[model samples]
Target: MADHCNGSSHSSESFANIPPIKFTKLFINGNFVDSVSGKTFEAIDPRTGEAITLVSKGDKEDVDLAVKAARFAFDNGPWPRLSGSERGRILMKLADLIEENIEEIASLDAINGGKLFSLCKLIDIPAASMALRYYAGAADKIHGTVLKLSKGLQGYTLREPIGVVGAIIPWNFPTIMFFMKVAPALAAGCTIVVKPAEQTPLSALYYAHLAKLAGVPDGVLNVVNGYGETAGAAISSHMDIDKVSFTGSTEVGRKIMVAAATSNLKPVSLELGGKSPLLIFDDADVDEAANIAFNGMFFNKGEICVASSRVYVQEGIYDKIVDKLVEKAKALVVGDPFDPQVNQGPQTDKKQFEKILSYIEHGKREGATLLTGGKHIGQKGYYIQPTIFADVKNYGRGD
Candidate 1:
């Protein structure tokens, strides 16, 4: 199916004019409230390595409240009793609402998560809205399977919504992850408590507000924003939750698996980090292939879990492709995300920035040839020069 998202058209007036942070409180029971401890954490702007706004910091106590709300909604609320078409209508309204406020929502992620403004507005946020609509259309189509039996004992299997769901999403693609996890659950009539990554919580909170405005019942969707060890760990182990869906690092995925098992043996869905690779043969178009390689390895500053970090080329085109990649890297623009000419934004945060630099140093020491740019671009933000390595040893991870 073709994507119906808005086209990429941004203005200097709008990109440069970012509005102030709108939603920062924990969303529960259809209301935005402060954390139990009244603690707040700074949501940083990677553009200048500074704090953009302070968001309510949720911990175990807050997570418990959010879970309770979701459980009650599942067990006693009107959402589960509503007709599937009614639920679908509400979800469709939510998607339309997201489009109505796309500018503000897109700007929030770009400012807080260090993603390119044009890309967020044009591609990511709009795609999220479309995803919601797609699931909305499927809401009414869920059904049970007919079965055959012998001896006049005929019956059919019934399908039902899973209970309360705990959704944990990474910061790399906040908008997409939010819908990818939450939409299907909502379509099936399951309430959810989401724990968005601390680095980028503003947009999730905004979406929560929009969901409520679109007539989704209170407690059907809740968002808790905080550090992973506290709020996230609580969600992973919460006994009342019927299922858990997580996306992030592999190490954390292990912890969630353990917690889900010991607490209640609840099933889990995890999307963990991995090194996906791309191989280019000699017959492919060198220029187009190089562009694909660059994008696969470096889109969103190479922050995606499926980023094609490892690339292999046939010996015949190896040198030629490397030359083309080098030229593209040199001409690439790196600066404020709002800049139309900027091809890449800063690392999501200082920790990510420093980690990439350390990895570059390690690669150099380990005998990988530094093929192109490998230096920090600016002193203000968490920026790094786009880098590539040649003559790399076939070193698997953790070797």
Candidate 2:
């Protein structure tokens, strides 16, 4: 692995403004350290096809360490023993820290995840803080229900923190997913062993630092960064993890379920992939529908799982909707995410870039007419123009 570098070689005016980054180690037991195996992996910058930094390459061994720490925290630490109001206060402090460091967090997300800097600054970072704060409020309110049993016998059930949680988040929305998983776990008073997707580990590590600063106790939260097969599988199958939460592809979700089932019969929650469709009726306003569809399908460079890639329109309004959508597609700016003028950025990595291009090729081969974009943007970077295919037919064989 290359030595830690600040990504200073990229000369884009926007890139220059980004804060320097140096923390690339795995966060475990409230400290950043190299992997036990002393291995590191290169984090690629999709915008420039250059190395951003070398992050610790965590595997099953690292997962075990993180999970053990979480288990210890849950079983013996003050975090779980603390009152809900105290926990809430701590989480609220974490939210404040997130807001205080929003710029650096948003910039890390933008540069590392190939996300729009403006969007990260304006939407993702704030949303993360909001999630933490909302969960913080909920922390004090975790309760139970009283039931009137049969024969006039009264009974009540109490809600308690389910031990350690293993959170496996995806690469598409790093900042949001981190809070979506971590905040709730923290609110519920469950210690966590987080396995951030390898592709976007910077913001998560930075978040861990901020979490420590906000007074999250050591061993209450741990982050192990690695590929899915190793760290993720370890978390899913670990006997100590009480719950496994995953957000990613269906294929991986299935594997997680099996691992959970086969190992300890642990409960699992999955937010897997979905096929989103946009339907427009003749009575709907054409321009309004066009803008919504464009935003729905093309936002985040079409990397969203719920991206509205499929469109169905009433016959009477088909031509008008397509014309407006096509015009909107053509107008989308594709370039560096940091550039305020550019609305689109490169694909998150080379694999996703090639995968999207392959799908575009398949769309053409399957007889869909390419209306606006059909090729890549520039010589460097994994960038494809905002592609639009019309006159499409669903010709594929189905299961």
What tens-digit string does per-residue lDDT give for candidate 1 at 42-98? 999998888978999999999999999999999999998888899999999999999
TM-score of each: 0.95, 0.95
Model 2 whole-model lDDT (C-alpha atoms) = 0.87
Candidate 2 pairs with clashing backbones:
none
lDDT of 1: 0.89
Error of 1 at 261 (Å): 0.4
> 1-399, model 2: which lDDT tens digit per residue?
110111212223354378888689999899998899999988888887778889999999998899888889999999988999999999999999888888888788878888998899899999999999999999989989999989969999999999999999999999999999999999999999998888899999999998999899999999999999988999999999999999999999999999999999999999999878889999999889998999998899888999999998999999999999888877777777887777777789888999989999999898889998877765667777777888998544682
Q: Residue 245, candidate 2: how far off, in angstroms?
A: 0.4
